[model samples]
Target chain A: MAKNLLDVRNLSIHYKIQGGWVYAVDDVSFTLEKGETMGLVGESGCGKTTTGYGITQLLASNAYLKEGSKVIFDGKDFVQMSTVPSKEYKGYRKIVEYHPEMREYRWKRISMIFQGAMNAFNPVFKVGDQIIEAIKAHEDVTDEEARKRVEELYKLVGIPVDRIDNYPHEYSGGMKQRAMIAMALALNPDLIIADEPTTALDVVTQDRILGEMAKLQKREKVAMILITHDVSVVAEMAHKIAVMYAGHLVETGTTRQVFKETAHPYMEALLAAFPNIKKEKKERLKAIPGSPPDLANPPKGCRFAPRCPYAKDICLEEEPPVVEVAPGHYSKCHFAEELYGELGGGESNE
Target chain B: MSEENNDVVIRVRNLKKYFELHAGMFKFWGEPIYVKAVDGIDFDIHKGEILGLVGESGCGKTTTGRLLTRLEDPTEGNILFEGEDIAKLKGKELKSYRRNVQMIFQDPYESLNPRFTVQKTVMEPLIIHGIGESYDERVEMVIKALEDAELRPAEEYLDRFPHELSGGQRQRVAIARALVLRPKFIVADEPVSMLDVSIRAGVMNLMLDLRDKYNIPFLFITHDIAVSRYMSDKMAVMYLGKIVEMADSDEIVFNPMHPYTKALISAVPVPDPDHKHGRVQIKGEIPSPINLPPGCRFWPRCPYAKKGICDVKEPPLVEVEPGHYVACHFAEQLAAGELETGEEAKEVIEESEKIES
Candidate 1:
């Protein structure tokens, strides 16, 4: 097999809170193939966004990658290479990760389209100027060549070519999203990290953008990491999915496996919480009770045990390993096999 | 649900709202060009039915809500509330109409003043209308309103500030404020859009419960089609400033007739992995409201816009099925949906596009 495009092994990220350190991404390990799409889904503050940041090394200065953590992207141990200090003026090793050199990998290797496209471009400059700047940053091309590329990208993402001179505010939300996509694809990157690209958009606009991305991904064969709360979006776009819970990788599997054969209760709870528009009349939705655990000091064993109905003594005492219950399917619950049987052909699901 | 019944609680016909933006200090007196936010959209919300107004951002969904609620008067249009033109209401009559037609804002965080206590927030509406005689009586009414919103053990929340409560709780306070006035109708503009995933469901359920208990009709404005499926009895899909399709929840979701409506439905992420709802990748963004293309507003984005008639004329919303309405010219040629793959996806989209033409 060819080398993986991205490999995250035993990667744990921590934030120094009032009470010690919060384990935001606890020993999460996953890999992406050359063209496959991996979806990371969870509720707010479940560490999916943090995992995306960890892959791009975009964590805050207070946050740190714990010892033995490794992020190997495109044959480079970026963590070690990124920690080179500039000088010892302050005596303490003021770690500098994601340096200016690392920026070469940021847009050229992996690009991101965050939730909102509001600040993605400067309001003062024309949208074409911004796209031109992005292209000129990585390419040794003249302004004319970059402008041609911008026009081509605008056409590629379905933005009218003539609208390039317009400022960012001139475009609608959907147009802005298309512009963001166009900017991200300016350099034919191997990986694209879209963090809630559709959350800010409505259904129809989101649909068009997702369809554009799907077509582009197939055309370019780029590996994508989609971070979102909407499970159904993942069902359509992703090949594999990893679910997070209070900084834990509780479940990981194919899209078919996770939604159909959900082994983790938190996964099941998430599915239950969402009211399907396709569902029939008079059916009441089951929203998950209580809030997520305090991230500053999470639970000892299973972080979700506090809200889980099936929690037992062992679950509260020891952390469950990510056990492969079936081929290409993984779950981090002690009662994984049992929950798999329980999730069989749910009522109102069909 | 009647096809010919015209029980108009709020009738907005040929409505228009235009913002005058300036370039610089010299341009302050310059001829301000209109944004044309809501340009001549006509709709009527029936008695006791939850009418959903849905569209994408900058498509005038919020503006339509504000116009109906009288929060902002239209530049031109007949806002007939209970057969009287509300746009022409005088001071006392306007206050009475305001009490009759209240509004619940999208962000509860902003809706409820952070400095005020929960009791004060719920009581402000009552105080405005001068319902109660004494402070004690008003406090009693405030606690009762909290109870009506299902903020149980009402005293616990009464003392709390907006920041002290969760997003769901703060929204409950907003609902209580709207409900305290005992309005017959309300304009809920993306009420649960800013809430958490788990908390959003609770707010929706609470709104539905309120609709049932109080018999309060709603003009629910949301970008989410699925939300219309949940809280609403009837839905009208908006594009630019026109209703492309309007019908019952089942008819709209399963048997959508407008091309825009079909695209909207297909884009919705169904939770089931086995369901094969294919997305229609429509070209171009929602056309600018200021300068909309002639004929159908959705024609520019319609996948079947290549058809001759779609580009020439706008189809009026006509009831094709027993209560299901569509606004597409080629409604008959479109086929019904089948399960999974094949022409099923195409049929689903074509049927809706038919209404748009």
Candidate 2:
């Protein structure tokens, strides 16, 4: 077996509600190689962010990872040990003792770059001070060493070192994002989970920032799990992609497999929803009617069946198991195999 | 109805908007510097075409939008809405002009008064326009407007406040108010920039759907090219408060004539892994609009700038290919021939500056 960086099996992260558990991530599983970029995509409320939180063991108070869920990352089982018992679960017993605390893996091993970086940094403090604090908090570096690291990180992220003394407000939307990336890289973590990093930026800035991030990933050999709604942004960086709809994995495959040959109806709707430059100016866009379902009480059958045009009787009666349609291509729909890549009516080989 | 059907509705020429920097508290004797927000940009909005005003932050896209809707008067130049100088119109006539052009603001939360209910919000525009004579008539109009905006089963949404509704619903209400007046042209300023991705398409589709239903022309101002590409019939690229490029939306995206247009196109993220990902990355930062560089406003940052001419002489908007107009000294070079990349242009600028000094 090849050595993988992050691997999970039967991963189920749940949220407490009044009547029943939310099942934010139900039996969700994927792996990230040492230096690969995997895109975790979904609609607004899907468990993409929660999955990131679960991997980092930073799940919120209302959320908890179920027992027997195995998450092996960097030779450490971040998931708690089983009470059902095993010889290898001796070291994991300590983590099992404390249910809430995250074994101090927040900043050192992996970090997350949240959406709206403007609010991530403090208003009062200068960007320079923030970077320095980030460095010192993770490692045993002195103030001077951290300051030097801050300058290096600033220059690396394309923001001028001179602007380090400036407050966060003085920076543009893109520049603020660079400062956030600089702070995140200050710890030199192996993996960075970025959530909608370029959501607020203009196209020009978005391209530049994404380019910088791609370059940094290449040079550092760091794994990036980018979560965004923009398919274009995901296509730019991520090698493999996953499309989530209403907390279910609709499609997951290589970029070529997904973009060229989208299997699920939700993916088809999402692609059609995007404005192609080839489209006529005054032409109407056919929107996907009916919003995502309520996670607390999702539908009996397919969560996306209400909005899905190709939905059938079976789709409304039972949840489709995620099956491998092709070589490493997975989708959770009863009719996915027959209807694979039929949205644009193009073959995967094409 | 298309843009040509109704004829040209709005035209702006040599529009210059400069804000005088008032002297601070201490001395108050220094010369007041002017912040030229909109510096000599010209474009036309044909009868009902969705003319997109595109640019990054501080490029005066929003300011130009405000000027079009007459939310703010220009410091200099004329905005001919239906062949009438909007600046000259004031008092009673200006109030009437306001009804002809309604403005949809960016933040739906801030634009709407929190205290007002959906019915009251939609009715304010009706009352101001002084249409639908009776109270019940006005209520009828409001319901119709709500239905048009996709707030279906209008009765349920009538009494709900802005806070009670979702972000998508609030934006729909904003659209409803704008539509209630039955305006010919609307300046929708960053309408969906704040909404969630899933909901943004819904709001955008509503705008386009309403455009067809009302035959209403919109001056859609947005920084996102994807939205602009889908929404705008004709497009204008603004750089440093000036109209740098103008052409049909498809033409601009597929075959960008101007260097700025090319850069902007390359900047748009293409969701195709087969595509070569290393795009033309413009480094540094957007120069301060307050102290804009001489010659071409973009010449300082333009990749194609050459010699002392760029620093000393400004370029005019020249017709490069048919309807495509680009404002650049090297527009011809790019139009007839492929010149160089942004990096190569930067190198040329460096050498030229060194020789001049």
Candidate 3:
């Protein structure tokens, strides 16, 4: 309804391999509102991480963007700058620096809390000094001012200020994660991309971290793109949910819509695959047959057709268009209505 | 199974493992600091039942698994396998015991050898145990193992290396290797934690199927309470280096009496958004195992701890409820709702303030 803070349209990212390009992320698009949380969830090699990395321009050397892709952030066409050439010198070949302005957006406007970020810190430096350096790198602040800000950020993330002086090894896994979250918030960024933020921690520590992040998100009003393979985590944290399989976004909707009125068969299978801790024991868990398709040489049509239980001949020959089952809910499936009808109703779900 | 007279497959009595640390330079200046990793633990695995050992990192769950498989010799106590003590087993007896008990590690990538093919990896266990008569017989055994692990069309995967397979495929190979010998008991330490959620259910179902088919008991160790609840029949909650509570899985999940168990259960994020978990936050960091706290090991961070009594003496594992064991001095009071939540620790603060005032 309101103007979206970040709009990614027709985004495709590929890696140049020996024979052909590895289509890591293909035709994936989603919008994130200001102060909203969107969860991008899938299994391994589902292009969930690549979508985040491509938006952040953190791809490796062998990777390159496909033609006709757009990433609009804060009313700016950031993806088009990749082809912008420098001024020609004496009618000769011109050098292209390739989106040097995008570097300025990093950490100041958009930042990331990486997976296994606790081990990413330098062991030699004190945690506070590292954060101080990060703060100084983005803004023209004095050493005294940066130090005070570092202390404040540490306290904001629920870490005791005194422990900020300790080295990374001195802190526990949970403390280091909290420290990473503090580092991501050092520059007051508008958006934070967290990839499996609490995967490595225990349940108790993960509970504390998720609770803290939720509190901080509400207080600071910073939009977040939480990427994880755990559906339960997304159910608790995000306002919207996007389900990806292979390199395709099979479904997208609000959290309630996706969880309650799921249309895509892949989404249904993925949901049933996870064992619910709160529910009673069933006779047997319904695990989806077969593995994810190979991204390097994925099949034509729908990527999930081979594993879809309700897939038909049309599903194998042509890819399904994005069909809006509800007002704001979309599923990339041909038989979405029939599937929903079979489930009885699209409005209520237990 | 009856409570008193059930046939136990593995009986662990007062198990202890203390790793002595050398602190000073040249190893001459300081007293040895013992990292009490698994200190005085006791439990029994019933025949054909899964005993889930749930704990956080550094809580000695993995160490307990390693000790059970004879990978690490216990410093004290007896590990009776089928009513026979295995601490003093040697040579042929130890080899035979190892054949009956196998271990499946967490990381599938690191567990299997890179150079070994799927066939070689599964066959190596059989070759070592001298199970089959000839090489031809071993090949048949390998194919059967792969099929039994649910890697159908086994011929297609025989030549593939670990790198060529997916995370779930590699884990199945690891399971195939573990099950090639048809072990009676297994110590699976977070087998599915390293896998993707979609494929995780398949592996869990395979494990349950194998357990039922082979009638094998498992010491399932994991930090995830949800996965443990799905897999294990009996659950044991561990903290620091001791079992804080042990009971039936459903009872432990529904009506947890121990404060630590309550905190752990409340910490687990349920998938449904409407499921509201009680907020029983256990504050502070777990104490370092190198120097454990006196009295109760959990006293430093326990919310329901009393001042004089809980800090003065450690409580033994008492059977407060039938078939439900708890190791806390105030287990009865806490279960009975007699003790306050200690939001401000009003009594403790008042008592300490009285001394100061």
Candidate 4:
């Protein structure tokens, strides 16, 4: 098997509130190979964004990782480096004691495309100068070389090079998003974490942007962790899929395997929630009933049991184990095996 | 157009709303530029029917809804509500007209007053319109409206503030407020876009139930085509302040005639991974509304736009098929697959196809 680019095991992060800790990301684990894309999809406050921030070690000041959490990147445990500084970690510890080697690793090996591009850019500075600053901050390049790279990035993201001198306010919504992507790819990082990149864009603009991002990811061999609530976008962009609900990974599998033979009830409900334009019959969407549980004091057993349609007494009484339904597919549910068996047997019914 | 039938609740004819843009230091003397927000759009909402106005952000769907609710005065046109022109109503007459037409704003958090309780929020509309005879009567009406909006045991939420409720619950309160007046027509602007996916269907179902129960016509404005298709009986595709296509929701989504509508429908990402969308990627961004193209507003970005006709003469919105309106010079040719995709659009698709492999 090809060496994994990133391997996260039992990663748990919690926010320190007034009374208790908010279990934002609880014991979530996943692996990503180089040039592969994994989509982290869930509704609001389901810890999808927190998971992305945990991987990058850019969590907020109030948030902290739990014990035994491991984020092994390129054969090195990044979580361990932060807690126990060694001789090789002295350079990182001197610069930032909290996040070891993050200054060197961030934007050099992994970059983030934020949710709101308008707020991400500096309104006072020109778009080109901001991207050039990003390039110059990481690499020891002169202003001329950074400017040339910015021009090339503009072309790559389908933005006009002449508009690089304009401020962020001057560009349209689509143009600003392209500039955000350009800045994320400024250093040619190995991985990109894009959180709702196309959520604010129009449908046509979003389609074009997703297409461009997919092409660039393939050409540059960059792994991505696309965090979104839209399942269709993940279906189109991601090779592997991870579904989250109430700070737990409900399901994780290949995109085709997960979507085709859905094991977890949350994943099934989520897929049914979206209105498909291609569906032959116009049927009412089966909306998942009730709201997500509070993370500060979540449910005892399955977090999704309160809203799940197939919840039984056992689901509420005991935590479900992660069962491997297929060779590489894992589902965190009590009836994952039974659901997978039924779905596999009746594949043609759908 | 038949007055005897009396089915059409709101008939908007040649509606135009142009916002003037002033530039430069001596802009008072200079020719003032206008952003043609709702430039001569015409549609009718029949009784109990939901006409969905779908488009991008600046495509004037919201402006049309605002005009229908009499929030914004149109520059020129006739707003015939039940065959009476309401374009210039004022004072008591405008207030009476507004009592029959209500608007549900997009953001429930911003629309509701922060200090007001749910009871006061929903009751203010009734008090303004003099809907009930007494305080007790108005409270009863508020409870009924809240119940109609799917907020079970409405009394439980009477004293709750906006912040106390969740996003979906806030939207439900907004819907109940709109319903308290029992208006003949309602304009819902992106009602469920801010809501979570899990509870969005419940809200949509509530609206559908309300429409059926009251037989009230609706003007549903949204950017998502799939949601519009599910909610609307008739759908209109707007681009650059004009209705590019108007047809039955299923017909328009399945067999779109206008190039812009085709591109819009095709652009919607379906949930199925195996289904391959017939990509009709339009080039470039929507042109600035202030300086719109001379002829067809979508010609600059349309994949099947012709040079001479689409650039020189604006095509009138004509019925190419039964009950289907299309505003394109080559609508028939494009529908027949006689016209080829533009060169630039083809190149863009080819360059962006590396991911499919």
Q: Which candidate leads in DockQ?
A: 4
Residue A13, candidate 3: alpha-carbon lDDT: 76
Off by over 4 Å in 2: A17-23, A81-103, A278-284, A345-350, B1-6, B22-27, B196-198, B338-357
Q: Give the TM-score of candidate 4.
A: 0.96
Best by TM-score: 4
Can you rank all candidates by DockQ, best first?
4, 3, 1, 2
Better of 1 and 4 by TM-score: 4
| Regions of candidate 1 where Cα sits further than 4 Å from its true position | A18-20, A84-95, A98-101, A139-152, A160-166, A280-282, A344-348, B1-36, B39-47, B75-85, B303-314, B330-357
| Local error of candidate 4 at residue B75 (angstroms) | 0.5
**Shift in Å, residue B203, candidate 3:** 0.9
**lDDT tens digits by residue: candidate 1, B1-357:** 343455668777778888755657636775665677877666677777798888778878898888877778788889888778998676898898999988999988888898999998899988889999999999999888899988999999988999888888888899999888889889999998887677788888888888888778899999888777887888888777667778887788888877778778877987777777665646556766666677777766665564467778878777778667777776645535322223444664564354233
What's the lDDT for residue A18 in model 2? 70
Tens-digit lDDT track for model 3 on B4-112? 5457999998899998887667267667678999989888898889999999999999999999999998999899899889976888999999999999999999999
Q: Could you give the TM-score of chain B for each candidate, in order?
A: 0.87, 0.92, 0.94, 0.96
Q: What tens digits encode model 4's per-residue C-alpha lDDT throughout B5-87?
A: 66889998899999977667536786778999999988888999999999999999999999998899999999999989999
Worst 10 residues of 1 chain B by lDDT: B335-344
Query: What clash pairs does model 3 have?
Result: none
Which 10 residues in a row give candidate 3 chain B its minimum summed lDDT?
B348-357
The 10-residue segment of model 3 chain A with minimum total lDDT is A86-95
lDDT score at residue B86, model 1, on the 0-100 scale:
90
Q: lDDT tens digits, residues A235-324, model 3?
A: 888999999989888889998778877888887887777766777654456688888887889888888999887878988889888888
lDDT of each: 0.80, 0.79, 0.85, 0.87
